[model samples]
Target chain A: MEVVLMDILGAVVTFLVAFVVGMTYGGLSRKITARVQNRKGPPFYQNFIDAFKLGSKKSAIHHGVMHHFGPAFLMVSSVMTLMIVPVLTHNQWFPNLNFQGDLIFLLYVMTFGPLGMALGAGQTGNPNSAIGVTRGLSQMVGFEIPWVLALVALMIQYHTTSITGLMAAQAHSGTWLMFSSPFAFVAAVMAMFGMFRYSPFDIVGAPTELASGPISENGGKYLFVMMSSGSVFTFAKLTLYVDLFMGGADNLLILLIKTFALYLIPVLYGVTTPRYRTEQAVRWFWGWPSFFGLLAILQAVFF
Target chain B: MMNDKNSQKIVDIIQNWARKHSIWVLAYGTGCGAIEIPPTMTSRYDAERLGVRGAATPRQADVLLITGYLTVKTMKRVIRVYEQMQDPKYVIGFGSCTINGGMYYDSYNTIKVLDKYLPVDVYINGCMPRPEAVLSGFAQLQKRIAEGRANGAQQYKDNLEWYRANQKKIIPNWIMPDYNW
Candidate 1:
């Protein structure tokens, strides 16, 4: 009973931390984008206000039962991903579920939310949502090749399929895997661009073109849930990358620093770039990123 | 305690505060006034600093900005868009065109009075309002939101029949979903 209660408490705390950090990062990205464009931006806490306002909205309409479950499914996936990723190197309070072969599970879990969302968007009877979902799924397929190859290369090189095992390998070696497996890191970071879905790769939900895509029909509380889930998911993905590439952080501050540094790579890149069409984006991903992934795999096999 | 008037007032206060800070505008650019929106949203005025961002659809929008003159044909679509928006929505009638049709007032097919068909929360008067005027208009909407007085959606609901009558007078063949809310 005590163990269960502790775990529950740990999960709640982990979620709260992820939520705050993720929302702040989103706000900071907006600020950075604003500054880049030579404009004054909203405060760093603006996203929080938007979330609160969305939640407080009096009415929400849904096309069907699936529409209602869409955000819930997204929330579940994000929280589940957060639970599987370790936040700190040796923290008792943040007792998350880490296990052997969890890396494979993580990949499956991350994509689960989008498929659920696609189901809901389809039920809305909106052509734009359908187009957006197809584009998003195709883009997912584009990025997944390099992402999987990078992970596979790391797993083969380190002789472990678990995220914790990979982290342990880095700790044992006294150097980050990013330094040891530079090609894998390069491939992974390149794939991260599409995964983050910032500009250039943001065709899936191109606001002007697709009417905000899959989320076009969702508003009020539904939007609120989606927004919060997105924040949690962002933090989780960033933490996963930090754990894999950088030696997993020993403390909260270090973890935040490492994750934010990794996060800036996609965000800064997105700000300066223009949007790419779905086909162009897919081809771009299959081109150089896949090549790097192949090189990573070859290097791992030889070394 | 949940139903207590004071408690509800407190909830309203909090909600109003949140709503005031985030005004997602769905600019229904019906006329040449659409030209000013880019500058307002981009480098010059930066309406985002005041939480006045552009929403892609009616579902996600809080404010329906009716920019420039609305013809009889466009008004039908505008009405449809306004009704599609969720509750607690505001409408800003922009420019002299929306107020009394501007130079198109004498011209046939242009709407002279916007409030006859839709409840407008604020009206910014100009031949074509500049980015500064648009920012000011957003500020006015924000102030009304904070005061909990921008209940244009509620007013529309309460007077749905009258608004519909006015709308139908212009749109002879009214083919629309019933105001479900």
Candidate 2:
């Protein structure tokens, strides 16, 4: 009972932290976007404030009973995603959560929230939203297989699924996983980055084409909850990368540097690329590097 | 019995105060005025010092700050969300969208005025109001609340017909968009 209660508490705290951190990125993106367009943007807390205000308002049940559960379902999955991910060392909230097995677990757990959202969007019966969710899901189907294959290679090479354990192995060998098998690392990094819906892959929520995509129907409180979830998911993924490739650093400063360096890759890529059509993203997901990802598997196995 | 009454009274007082000070704003970024909300609430203007926070759940919010214009589609969902919020709530329409239609004034979908659909506590005027304008609107709202002049939830309840009528005028199809279908 005590452990269960602590887990809930930990989840809540992590959720809040993720929300704030994620919004900071959103604010940062907005600023970056404005600079690109030669405009002065609002402060970073803009997304935060927007989400908070909307979440607090009275939740109206629009589109009937199923819509009522949409926000609740998304919120649950988001918090659960935090629970499954290894956020802290010494395992602050969930002691059972290990870095190794948790990575694979993280992949599966994260899948549902988006699926639920796509379903909810379909329920809205708006052709645009339905089309958005369909495109988002189709994109998901194409990339997820290659992404999983890449992860499988990582697991086979390291001989562990625990994120912390993988990092520990690297520390002992005086090498990072990215160095051992650059292709796998690249493929994994790209897949994860694409998963974030940052440029080129932002088809699911394409404001231009789909009007905020699956969440087109959401407004006020519902919209805030969704944005809050997006925020926490970002931090969680960033932290996951840190654990996977750059853990075992002694002090906070080195860890921060490594983490930020890892994050910059995604940010730079996001800022530079134009949006990819659904078909093009799938082709990229399945075509070129994904084929090399198999060679990465062979390299990890034979070497 | 006395303690219960006192507790009830205390609860009422706190709720009333929360309703006023911590007005969580949902400035849906559908227009230019959406940009002004951040400065009005962040460090330079610091709306937080007044207890106003941007919340993520409707159950936790007391006020909905609709920053600017709403299209027919956006207004439909906005009305639905507004209805979900608990009573004793207030709505503040920032910039010309809430007052009149502003730039989208002649647009077919944009509501010429917000009060036509929802009860508005304050009407902030600016083509796209600046942070200062939003702050002034917040002050005006606070004043009205303090003076017992603002009765949003009560008015909404006591005059259901009026509320219904107002929403009907703005939301072309007073029927809530069925997202569940």
Candidate 3:
């Protein structure tokens, strides 16, 4: 009973930390984007205000049961992913379900939210929603090839399918995987551009073109849940990358620094770039990122 | 003991503050006044600093900015958009055009009085308000929101029949979803 209670408390703490960090990162990105464009942006806590306002809104319309459940589904996926991906290394308070073969499970759990969103968007009977869902799924397919390949390369090189095992390998070797397996890190970071869904790869929710796409019909509380879930998912994905490449962090501050450093790759890149069409984005992913993934696999096989 | 009424008042205070800060405007660019919006949102003005941002759809919007003169044909669409928006929404009558049709005052198709058709929270009087004026207009709306007096959506709901009657007179074919909310 004590073990179960402690685990529950740990999970809650992990989620709260992830939520706060991720929301702050989101706000900072907005501020950075504004400064880049020569404009004074909203406060760093703007996202928090938006989330609170959204939650307080009265959601009067929902197309169906699926529509109502969409955000809940997303929340579940993100929280589940957060649980599987260990936040801190060798910490008693943050030990969140780090087991063998969890890396494989993580990949599957990450994509689960979008499929659920697709169903919810489909039920809205909006053509734009349908188009956005298809575009998002296609983009997912585009990035997954290189992403999965990079993970497979890491697994092969380290001889372990678990995230904790890989982290242990880095600790034992005294060099981050980013240094040792540079090719895989490069490929994965490239794939991270699409995963983060920044400007060039943000066709899924193309506001100018698709009227905000899959989330067009969702507002009020539904939007609130989706936004919060997105923040949580962002932190989980960033933490996963840190654990895989940067050898994981020993403390909260170090974890944040590494994750934020990794995060800048996509945000800064997106700012200078223009939006790519669906096919163009897919091809771009398949081109260089996939090639890097192949190179990473080859390097793993050879050395 | 904290009673239900006190708790409700506390909730209302927090909600009003949030609504005041984050104003998502769905710009219904009905006339030439639409030209000013790009500058207002972009580098020169930067309405985002004031928590005033553009929303893509009616569902996500909080303020409906009716920019310029609304013709009979466009009013129908405008009303449809307004009705589609969730409650606690505000409408800004942008420019002299929206206030009283501007240069198109004598034009046959243009709406002379926007308030007769829909509840408007703020009116910016200019041939075409500059980005500064637009920001000022948003600030005015924000002030109204903070005072809990921006009840345009509620007024529209309460006086639905009068608004509907006015709307139907201009629009020949009245086929729309009932205002159930």
True contacts kept of each: 0.85, 0.05, 0.75
Model 1 stretches with alpha carbons more than 4 Å out: none
* TM match of model 1 to true structure: 0.99
User: Best to worst by DockQ, what's the order?
Assistant: 1, 3, 2
Q: List the residue pairs that clash in candidate 1.
A: none
User: Which of the CAPRI classes, incorrect, acceptable, medium or high, describes model 3?
Assistant: high
Q: Which ten residues in a row have the lowest lDDT in candidate 1 chain A?
A: A53-62
Model 2 collision count: 26
Query: Candidate 3, residues B53-144: lDDT per residue as tens digits?
Result: 89988898889999999999989899989888887789999999877778998999899999999999999989889888999999999889
In terms of docking quality, model 1 is high
Off by over 4 Å in 2: A1-16, A62-66, A91-96, A99-101, A248-257, B1-181
Docking class of 2: incorrect
Candidate 3 lDDT: 0.92
Provide DockQ values for all models, in the order shown: 0.84, 0.10, 0.84
